[model samples]
Target: MFICSLFFIYIGEQLDVEKNLKKTAVLVGNAVFYVPSIIKMTTIGGIYLLAILLPSFLAGYRDYTIGTDVLVYGNIWFHNAILSNNFWNYLEWANNSSIGVLYATFNYVVSRFTSNVHIFYFWYSFVETALVLMTLRKNRIDIVLGMSTYYFLFFNLTLNILRQSLAMIVIVWGFNYVTEKKLWKYLLIILIASGFHSTAMIAIIIYPLYWIANNREKLLNVFVLSVCILFIVFSEKLTVLALNIGMLNERYSDYLMNSNIRGGFFAHLLFCLPILILYLTAKNNIGGSRDSQRYNGFRLIVAFTTVLSGFNLKYVYLGRVTQYFDFLFLLAVPYIGNRYYVKIGRYRDTLVTKLLIYIYLITYWIIIYGVQNSGETVPYILNFN
Candidate 1:
């Protein structure tokens, strides 16, 4: 994970350099600096060594976990799905006959040649990490920072849900496609992802709505009201429907019902209040432009989604539907910290500012990891070894 973070930072810096030769040199330099000289090491030890070296080697690297999902899922795909030939059974269950046959053929070919699942895990992680890097490139955020964010680490490392993780990668890639107005390409990606996990179908729904959400305020109210009503009137039905979908296992269902929505609510509240306060204090600061308006609209929609997580666990359990919005809070809080509070001329580059940001990010991670690990709500079956 940490080596991957360094790789992203190196790529980001090299993105600005001119000439293909210089770019190639930069890539080689990064690999030489980062990749180990040792020919062999245990996976866990290697990961630990990289983690320790990452921050020292790349001062600007932020821990991102987008690739973690692929790593976990790839482990599962290699061990349970391919090794045991269960992937065909899953495909058969979905009535994807052609896909089952293709997967069977691939599995047979691989098993005839190699028995090491770790190799498969590594290859899958590499490819998935590349895909995630590409998606992050489209967003123009710091790839290292984006990789380190809670969105990637918590779900990928802790939850260790493989199919859903792949689905998320697909969703991220789909977002890039949709944003570029490549509808057919976006749909194709979504379909491919859905083969891995049905939850990805949600992306199909979210994309069109994201496009239709032109009237931000109105859309906010409608989505909030609709979710609330859906919870109140159809929570049971929704629960049953989720069960029918067979995406979630029994353990996850119990977690949704038993866990305290209050803490989640409070977290959302804390996140939303800051945004609200910032908006009130700096509404005029935005200078009233179309882009500003669009940003504001995005803020509101995300804030509303965060708040809605508190309204119903059913929604949260519905494949972390609310989490898609939670990313907004993650991005917003940092921006707000830097924009409103840090820029008051009292704390620019000061120890206090840095400490506050560090503490906030650390605390955020602790809270997120704590809540996730609070119970056996979800399975952690990754081949961490």
Candidate 2:
């Protein structure tokens, strides 16, 4: 799996360069452009081969977090009689209240067929990975760096948020529909995903915002400032309403009120400063007016949401909102790395960029592993193992 992942990453990077080269060649009316286009076509074939092999690799990897969550869901379903009442209740509160129904359902279907829940996790991981890869492919991103970034966000740490991960798939599906101007498909997917997790319903509002805000690059900074202030002043009230309206677990009420996961007040400011610097530096350097405008707009949104995540712990949910923007950066980073660092200078200049990437990877890994290894819960399957 790791080897295949590396191969896909290489193909994606090569194709990215080739695609750009083709666009440049078209502008210059040069026959030399054919070389890059041909290389891109070859890379496409390599990508397809890697995609074919990904499933086998993912299937062999253990999803430790999903295994633990499944066990927690099973125990809640079986141990608590309230959750076993009916299918609706099973869907709504089984993981929190009743373990029997959840256990029975899984045992009758998922567990009964598989050797253990880890296998189920593996399958889910594979499907999620495939869905993300398809989404990126559709977006015309085929590079290894792009795939790595997508995998890190969607399959790595996100495995802990099973419902949210599924919601993300629906959200991306909705994004495609919106981009294609397919209203019905977009709404349908959003609604279906909302049924699985109520938080997804928020996308109904966010989608419209996404549409309206698509071209509004300057407004992103304003929106970020506004959301920060609104959350800061009304956080308690918002938490109360969220709990009352059943958007948040009641147990989290106190945590929301008293906990201080706010990181640092200036943390977001610090992060945004670099992006702001990049934007200023690249504003004139970028080619293609339309593409530059789109990138600027997208970067603003990403910067806004990332800053908001640090302003308040409750805005942790807004992490999903920032993820869409983070994806843009993930793609841009490698291109930028290649352009300014790798191409203009020695490959050694790319070392800093690579170190920054590894730093992010390691930091996220620590956060995820810390949460998973806290030992508050254990998967039933692993217990047997």
RMSD of each: 8.8, 8.5
Query: Could you tell me the lDDT of residue 344 within candidate 1?
Result: 54
Please, what is the TM-score per model? Answer: 0.59, 0.60
Candidate 1 on 270-294: residue-level lDDT in tens? 5345445454454232234543534
Per-residue lDDT of 83 in model 1: 45
Local distance difference test, per candidate? 0.45, 0.48
Q: What would the per-residue lDDT of candidate 2 be over residues 1-385, giving only the tens digit for each residue?
A: 4446757657554555656456323233544543556656666666755664574345334434332344445333333333244545554554353222323444334443554554555555555566666665565543455455554433443444444555566576455665555778878876766544444544544444444445456677467546644644465577679878876667545433321221223333333445444444432323675444445444554555555556435453343344443434544443433332222343345445445554554454344334433222223112234
Per-residue error (Å), model 1, residue 259: 6.6
Estimate the lDDT of model 1.
0.45
Cα lDDT over the full model 2: 0.48
> Number of clashes in model 1?
5
Candidate with maximal TM-score = 2
**Residue-level error in angstroms, candidate 1, position 125:** 3.5
